[model samples]
Target: MSESIEMTAKAPVRSAPAPRRTTPAPRRRSTRRGPLHPATWAPTTVLVLILGLIWSAIAAEHPYILPELSEVGLALVDRPEVFLTNAWTTLSIALAGVACGAGTAFVLALVMSEVPVVRRALMPLAVVLNVTPVVALAPGLVLAFGFGMTPKVVVTAIITFFPVLINVTTGLRAVPPSVLHVFETLHASRTEVLWRARILYGLPYTFAALRVVMPLSIVGAVVAEFVAAGSTGGLGTMIRNAASTARLESVYAAIACLAAMGVLMLALVTAVERRVLFWHESQRRAST
Candidate 1:
């Protein structure tokens, strides 16, 4: 009887760790995918391959004008500190100028958008500035702002502002009339319309402008530095110094650093766009 009771006690407990219920881990979005996903690394690989071939061709055909890729690589590897410091300086000028310029453009866009007459009045001024050759104006800017960071910053800003202004103005006007009408029916204020509808509508266009303007600002600052050449401590200065003594390797290295800086900024902008515009159709499509 005791043995029978023991067997009954040991038999079939109802609980068995509740079948180990677990939520599956969420999958990560991998930037690096297999060749099956050609969109991942195919273009980048192709670009690098093409660049390598062109570089080889240049090295073989015109050795004096363009140093071998290996030489540029050696120079870059040897002078890490110089490249880093100069790259930082150039990047700073680009960032500061773009931020300020984009802000000014947004304000001007708002003003022009709300008041149609301001477009006629303000556009001529923008056109004049846009048409003025920045290289020709660099010396004057240096004279006015002194041979320092101010001139470079101003030059960068001037180069970036107009394109941004045009983009923002277009974006603000691109809001659907139906959406505006809905807000109107609800008796929304001008500020509400401006912020909720127009600004949101303009974000993609503004980002597109940003992608172009940021690189142009970098170019602008570099050119300004060239015109105001000295110990300014930027990629432009490095280029000027290298070119003076015909150190083609160093010139190529500095140029490569400049390219890297532009690429980094562009990547950052793209990342921000992905985060901010995740709900947009483009982002949705890209993610899938």
Candidate 2:
């Protein structure tokens, strides 16, 4: 018994088997799609269908009211130079007017945001301008600035000014009270507060206003072209001349060009807004 006990004590202890670690099964990736998935192409598909319908109507009815798409296409293709030159002219006027108007409105908005007195004083005049007919003002502008590009640009600027002023002012004042308090605690100067906080916060609003005013600038330019004496070139001028001559194809062609320009301008503003406001919630949602 003593020998057996000694052997048992000398024997090495065997350990229980270790547990095998089982990793969780890999989770399946979601098959869901974002907002910009292939389904978003529905609008473009609809547009194509509408064009097809129009083509069919032209083929069946032979309508004098609507020129054949091919004829309009040929009008554009044949005199590309004429259309290109006018398009450039109108585009330049719109660009210049937008720059001038938006800049001026931004400055005024800054002032109005800082001073209640200035805002109260200017608000009435702005309302007056907004209410006044742009067509009525065109002749006076022509009389004052002459029939050069100046009048057209001024008209566009006038058209774009109020929208920017309103939007930017609202945006500047839209900053949260907590943010302003934080700035105050930092002993930030007015200029610093404006540059650092207000301007940055106002960007989205400014772009929203821009999206509106950009297309509006085109209309303003065209209206000026229609009425301003001695107006020689632009899509508006082409349209007027073509219409007077009963050149239905040319008229439609110019109209198409104007439509294209408006779309391009809107797209441009949207693209810029996306780039600048990439961190904004709207852009975040769009990306996802």
Candidate 3:
């Protein structure tokens, strides 16, 4: 009986299966990172300093051609009202032109992106317009529109439209096939596809173009005003008058005003980009 009990216990112990060993799971990485420091601004700071130094050197060497920064400052202070009024006029015209041009470009780009035939027809026209020199057309526009702000605005629009059109069209077509397949399976309508997929997908590129287009539009407006030669109320006209009268410092002041306007426009576009394309990689990195 003792041998039988012992044998039974041994048999049961040997027959039991071993416990399965479990491997531990790997650690997951955290996606969080810290904000950008002041060092992030280093490149822009260096560029500004370099530009200032070069400008100072040029002003010191050629007092007649390039007025001293201090002289330009004095000119700005001496006639603040004139500067403000002229600058306001220039801003008004430039902003108007940009708004109109951007709107038109957006509609045309949407159409072209969806319809391959339209894209084939319009893309060549866009390229030709882009390659056409603004200087050559500005004079003709002024002659046709009779030296008014109308002509200047049209000239600015013509100069700025191509970039917006090209960039937005490129972006609209850039939606991935995988994403489009999802939409297709869901049976989304054409308007839904455009609004939910294409336009939203293209938002970053549109804003990117805006960043370039806004300042260039301002420059175009000012240049057109200079060519038109009848207006005394904008920065371009002020610069022309100052140059003709040999007031180099005043001309420099007008140039400074133009630069300030360009900077403001660029800043505004950047702000809008952050707000509108906040989901984009560029903005995401910037925010982080």
Candidate 4:
């Protein structure tokens, strides 16, 4: 017994390791992308069904005021070329105008972001311009620029400019105070901060504005067409002409094209935003 005790005492002793202060692995949040995926077109499918039901009810009740979607479909099928031609004209001018306006707005927004004096002077002016009815402004633009694409382009620019400028400016100012202070401490140049931080952070905001402004550009173009007596072009002209002749089906058909155009524009912007902002946290959350 003595020998056994001595041997045991001589043996190495082991105590249980203090419970490891392990951080539990972070809970993996499950993310699924089946029906809810933005690419799934699920919402659009449901909307189309709802629209179909509404159309059927309207067609059965008052075909005169709101003609059957079938009637509009027939009109579109019968003279697709006419509709396409007018649509192209309107789209062309709207595209050009939006491009010019967006470029100008970007430059102006950047300047406003950098210069308090400019921001103070111009923001209210921009708001005033934005609030002025395009209906009223279109006529004068037409008179000034003559009844050409120029007036319509100007009108579209007027419509698209403010939203982009507002969003970009708001985004520029959204930088964290700490981040700005750090940059100042580091003596970063204005141009450096503008390009690397402000512009990068402002992308999401700018894109949101793009989505809102696109349809507005269409409305502006149409309004300009209404006032552009000598335009002799565009779906708006066709619409006004058809309405005057009491061709209600044609009017509906033309309006459908406008709706389609708006949908396409929104889709284009959404796709671009998704691609460009894939690394952003909000965008990543949406994707997952």
Against the reference, the lDDT scores of all candidates come to 0.88, 0.90, 0.86, 0.87
lDDT per residue (tens digit) for residues 195-215 in model 2: 999998999899999999999
lDDT value, residue 116 of candidate 4: 94
True-vs-predicted CA distance for residue 287, candidate 2, Å:
1.0
Model 4, range 1-288, lDDT digits (tens) per residue? 999999999999898889879788998776756667775777889999999999879878987778877888999999999999999998888888888888789899999998999999999999999899877877777778887799889988988998899898998888888888888999999998988789888998999999998877788788778877697988899999999988989998999999899889998998899999998887888866
Superposed model 3: Cα runs more than 4 Å off? 1-37, 40-54
Q: Could you give candidate 3's per-residue lDDT for residues 141-243 as a string of tens digits?
A: 7678886688888878887899899899988998999989999999998889899999888988888899999999879888878776577678888888888
Candidate 4, run of 10 with poorest lDDT: 30-39
The model with the greater lDDT, 2 or 3, is 2
Q: List the residue pairs that clash in candidate 3.
A: none
- Over 177-253, each residue of candidate 1 has an lDDT whose tens digit, in order, gives 99999999999999999999999999999999988987787898798788863445889988998899999999989
Per-model root-mean-square deviation over C-alphas: 10.4, 5.3, 4.3, 3.7
Give residue 49's error in model 4 in angstroms: 2.1
TM-score of 3: 0.84
Global CA lDDT of candidate 1, please?
0.88
